[model samples]
Target: MEARLDLAGSPVAGKALKHFIAANTALAGSTLPRATRELVEIRASQINGCGFCVDMHTKDAAHAGESALRLNLVAAWREATVFTEAERAALELAEQGTRIADAGGGVTDEAWAKAAEHYDEDQLAALVSLIALINAFNRLNVIVRRPAGDYRPGQFD
Candidate 1:
């Protein structure tokens, strides 16, 4: 139940986290829709089995008014009727981004084009950066075996 290391207590990780927080602030202000952002974050976390991120993002999304149905159905998003095309595209990109090793070629042209159909250039940039950032957070938490279910909305803020 204990994390292997305290990321906040380590000077190296603390500095990295500061810049990460700043980068996230910049991404938050991007043109990507707030709901889609949360969805992508949660979906990627779930795929990576990063319980800390799943708890954090789900709480944050709910605090921002994301419906419980959508949150519960992120793993089954393809079959769910609760999402828009834009949201679907974002989720597809997140899946591809998170499962790069499985796919063997990273994100495919089809997924990228599907995502491009919905998001503008800036939003696409944000989505790509968000995927990378969330994966980084997921890997850090998963490798450290961070426990879940205790996160509060805005805990990081």
Candidate 2:
């Protein structure tokens, strides 16, 4: 399926996405581990049903040495035994952040506390930013009906 609009071709969208991409780049350099960041992005994309992002992040994760087993289990991370406590906490926070509308009150104190237990303030900042950023990308891609499966690792870079 074709996208409703080519985000890169539209002047306004292109400009906005430039900044968004920059923000994402900065967040990538945060204290958060690369593996955790990719996992968070994948989990958030899965929750938002953004196939483009799910495909992109999964491929990117694989390029960064993420295992197929871990990538496949991201959707069912809670029940999966392949993740560490820190990774699990990040996934929990990502889910809560993505489902904010459903939860009404947004990320819970328990979730926040759990995440804090695993991550320092800088890492938490990165996690929060990553969640919000991925959700934005998810909404944009999902709204446009952007088809997946063509993404290559580091294609944007």
Candidate 3:
């Protein structure tokens, strides 16, 4: 399927995406674990129905040596036994952050407390930033009707 717009080709999007790419680069260098960041990105993309992001992050994570079972289980992480408590906490925060409207009061105290327990302040900051960033990406891709399944890991780089 064709995207409704070529976001990367547009001047408006180019400028905005430059800043976004910069922010992502900063996050890439953050203290958060790559695995947890990827899982959070994937989960948020899934919740937002942004197929392009799901394809991108999943492929990127796999190329970085993440296990297939863990990748597959991200969607069903709560029921799967493949993840550690830290990963589960991150995933829970990602879900609650992504579906804030559903929760009404935004991310609950329990989710934040759990995430705080698993992560140090810097990592927690990175996680919160990641959640916001991924949600923004999901909105942009979903808005532009970005197509999925052709993304190569590190294609953007």
Candidate 4:
């Protein structure tokens, strides 16, 4: 299916995305582990039902040496045993952060505490920013019905 609009072709969307990409580029230097970052992105995308992001981040994660098993298990991360404790913490935070409106409390104190146990202040900052950013991207893509499966790793770089 075609997207409702070509985001890259629209000046308004394009300008906003350019800044978004720039922000992400800056966030890429965060101390959060690359593997965890990808996992968080994938998990948030999965929760948001943004196929384009899932496809892109999964492929990008694979290219960056994440195992197929781990990638496959991200959706079932709670039930899967392949992830590190830190990864699991981040995933839990991502889920809670992504589904903020689903729960009356937004994010639970327990989830935040768990994440804080695993991440330093800088890493937590990055995680919070990443979660918010990915959710924004997911909403835009899902709203536009952006088709998935054609993304090449680093295609935008």
Candidate 5:
């Protein structure tokens, strides 16, 4: 399958994505744990049905030493025992944030509080930005029907 457009080749999309990538790089330096970041990205992509992102993040997670079991269980994280409390809280936030329209009011206070218990202010900022960034990428990929399963770890970096 072919993407409807090559995002990197389009000046408009390219400019926007450059800023997006810069934002992501800044977020990457935040105190949010790298493992949690990947899990949250994967979970949000899963919810959004963005196969391209799911493939990219899953591979990236694996390359970063995330266990296969944990990767496979991200979708069912609520029922899984492999996640830490902090990771669980992040996952809850990611879900609520990604499904904002379905929930009608966006991320709940309870979810935010739970995440707050685990993250510092800077970490929270990164977590929020990562959620938004991943969702934007998800929508772009989903809309283009980007094919999956060919991504390599660190392909973008």
Candidate 6:
């Protein structure tokens, strides 16, 4: 498969993506745990069928020592036992946030309350921003038909 456009080669895309990439960099310094952030990204990418992102995040998470068991279970986290309550809360929020179009009311109050229970305000802010960020990345990659399975860990870094 081939991408519709070369985001790296296109000055217009590069200009737009620079800000998105910067936002992601800032979120990396936030209070949200790296593992949790990767899990959220992976789950959102999966929901969006963005294989390039799924490939990128899964490899990055594994490179950072995320267990294969946990990584594989991200798609089925509700039935998995490898995650903590906090991680579960973040995943739930990611799912709800990513599927907002499917849910009429956006994220449910219960989901937000649960996430709030597990995360401080700053952490919650990071989680929210991460969700939005990953969804944007997913849309970009999916829209362009970016191929998967060639990503290297730290390739973007």
Q: What is the TM-score of each candidate against the true structure?
A: 0.98, 0.98, 0.98, 0.98, 0.98, 0.98
Candidate 1: regions farther than 4 A off: none
Candidate 5 per-residue lDDT, tens place, 1-157, comes to: 8888888899999999999889988988888999999999999999999999999999999998999999999999999999999999999999999999998899899999999999999999999999999999999999889899999987888
* Cα lDDT of model 4 by residue, 1-157, tens digit: 9999999899999999999998888789999999999999999999999999999999999999999999999999999999999999999999999988886778899999999999999999999999999999999999999999999998998
Model 3 Cα lDDT, one tens digit per residue, 43-80 = 99999999999999999999999999999999999999
Give candidate 4's whole-model lDDT.
0.94
Q: After superposition, which runs of candidate 3 have C-alpha atoms over 4 Å from their true positions? A: none
Candidate 4, position 72, lDDT: 96
Task: Specify the poorest-scoring 10-residue window by lDDT in model 1.
Answer: 148-157
What stretches of model 2 exceed 4 Å from their correct place? Answer: none
| Cα lDDT listed for each candidate | 0.94, 0.95, 0.95, 0.94, 0.95, 0.95
With a 3 Å backbone cut-off (N, CA, C), the pairs that clash in candidate 3 are none
Name the runs in model 6 displaced over 4 angstroms: none
Off by over 4 Å in 5: none
Q: Lowest-scoring 10 consecutive residues by lDDT in candidate 4? A: 99-108
Residue pairs with backbone overlap in model 6: none
Provide the clashing-pair count of each candidate structure. 0, 0, 0, 0, 0, 0
Candidate 6 local Cα displacement, residue 73, angstroms: 0.7
